[model samples]
Target: MKAFLLLLGCLLATPVLAGPRVELVTSHGTLQLELNEQAAPLTVANFLRYVDDGSYNNSLFHRLIPGFVVQGGGYDSGYSALPSYAPIENESDNGLSNRTGTIAMARTQDPHSATRQFYINLADNLSLDGGRSPGYTVFGRVTAGQDVLTRMARVPTGMNMQLRARDVPDEPITLLEARRLSEQAGGTMTSEPVSKP
Candidate 1:
C-alpha cells in the first residue's frame, strides 16, 4: 500500500505536455494564446520569436474591423509598421478555420507575405478558409480574455494618417507586455515537430 501511494503521488506531480502558451498583456486585459504547432508549425515558430524577443511590448492593435477581426503584433502606438523578419509560407490548409476567437496571420494579397502581423477573428470568417482563395494561416487561438477582444471591437475607429489606413483605433489599445506563459507555470516554450498535411 505504501509503494502504491508513492507511485500515485509521483504520477500526480508529473506535468502534462502541451503546445506553447503565450500571454498578451494589453491595456484592456491579459489574453492567453495557445499556438497550434501541429496545424501551423512555421507560423507558430515565427510568432514565438517576437514574443521571446519582447518585440510585441508596447505594440498597439492598429486595425479593428467590426464583426471581422482585431489585428496587431506589428504596429506601435504611433501606428508605424515595425520591422519584421522574412515572411513565412501560408499554412492555411492545415485544417484550422478562421473561426471566432481564432488567430490568423495578417498578410497582403501576397499569400506568402505574412511576417509579424496577426489578427483574431471576431466571427466565423469562412472567407479566410482555404479552397479557391489563398487563405490566411490560422496558427493560434485566444484561450482567455475574450472580453478584452470584444471591448476592442467596439472602440471608435477611423482612417489614420500615421497608419495611412482605415479602421484604425482612435484610442490606441496598447499591448503593454508579452511573454511565454510557460515561464510562469514552470514549463518551457519549445517548438514541436509539425506533421505535414
Candidate 2:
C-alpha cells in the first residue's frame, strides 16, 4: 500500500514537477513567458521563487530604453530600490540566444552576477551573448504578448537607466502585476492573479 501511495503521489505531482509558465500583465497587455526548466532549471526556479514570494509586486520598470529593452523587478512603486540578494552564477552558455522577444536575467557588467531583476530583449542583443564576453542567459521566450512588448518599446525614454549610467526612461514604466500561469493539458500555461503588486 505504501508503494502504491508513493506511485500515486508521483502521478499527482508530475504536473508541478514539470515547472511552470509565467505571465507579465503590463499596462499595455499581457505577456506569456515560457520558462525552460530543462535548460535553465536554477534560473527558472529562482524566478518562480520570486513570483511565489511576492517579490515583484508593484515593482516599477525603473529602466526603459526605447528600442533597447524594458527592465524591472527590483524597485518598488515609489522608485525606492529594494534590498537585493547575492548575485546568481552566470548561465549564458545554456544554449539560449539573445534573440528578440526572449526573456533573460539582467546583471551588472560582471558575468555570473544575475539577481532578482530581468529584462525582455527589444532587439537582438548579440553583443551580450558571449561572442565578445559572457552572454546573457536566455531562460525563456515570450510565448505571447509580443504586441505589448512592442508597445513598451515605443514608450518615450530618457536618461534614468537603472544601475547603469546611461539610457533610462525619463518616466519609468511600472509592472502592474506578475504571477504564475496555470497548467494546461496541452496548451500554453495561463496565469491567475495572485495579487495586485
lDDT scores in order: 0.87, 0.77
Error of 2 at 165 (Å): 4.9
All candidates: CA RMSD in angstroms? 6.8, 7.1
Q: Write the per-residue lDDT of candidate 2 for residues 1-197, one digit (tens) a residue.
A: 99999999999978655446787767678888888888888788777777877777678776777666778898887667776667777888878888888888998888878888999888888776765567888899888898888777777766543455455555566776788888767854666767423
Residue lDDT tens for model 1, 48-80 = 888877788899888889899998989877777
List pairs with backbone clashes in candidate 2.
57-197, 58-197, 90-112, 161-168, 182-190
- Which candidate has the highest lDDT of all? 1
lDDT of 1 at 177: 81
Cα lDDT for residue 94, model 1?
Answer: 95
Error of 2 at 72 (Å): 1.2
What TM-score, over all chains together, does every model reach? 0.84, 0.79
* Regions more than 4 Å wrong, model 1: 1-17, 183-197
